[model samples]
Target: MEYQYPFSYDWTTQEIIDVIKFFEAVETVYEKGMNRDEFMTFYRRFKEIVPSKAEEKKYCNEFADSSGYSPYHVVKKMKESNPGDFVKMES
Candidate 1:
């Protein structure tokens, strides 16, 4: 299956930090203003691990509620993993 936030290899640390900050800010805002039930929904949606079906459903549910407002969305810089040993990207 195609990754929703498909990893990119060229991203700098600064870029990733910037995204993290933004996500945190959104979490803070929603936590302050939204009700407990909605906030719980938001929190669950935020902590979703990569490549999980449960996470995918939370994403769809959040989209329906806000029409496209989520804080957990991050562009991960993922590399291939080897089951038995280290995997390296082509250089």
Candidate 2:
């Protein structure tokens, strides 16, 4: 909440919103919990906006540094979980 979401100046308004939603979903995993399907939906949109793995790592690392939530870990859990399962993170 104290830090802004990492984004690109070239992105469209909707793309920026979608990226924020994706970060919010990551935050939700640490704060409460998010369903795997819902998280994946946002994540898919995020990947569409930032298709590069290096860029994804940069943004995710920035967010994690500011918020203490790791998008990578949540995503790893999502990949390991079945659909409808809730993803949550502690740390």
Each model's backbone clash number? 0, 0
| lDDT (Cα, tens digit) per residue for candidate 2, span 1-91 | 6888999999999999999999999989989999999999999999999999999999999999998899999999999999999878886
* Residue 22's lDDT in candidate 2: 97
Q: Model 2: how far is 59 from its true place, Å?
A: 0.6
lDDT of each: 0.36, 0.94
lDDT of 2 at 38: 94
lDDT of 1 by residue, 1-91 (tens): 1123322244456544443443443444444432334333334443433246664555444542453334333111111222232212121
TM-score, every prediction: 0.29, 0.96
TM-score, candidate number 1: 0.29
> Where does model 2 exceed 4 Å of error?
none
Best by TM-score: 2
Best by lDDT: 2
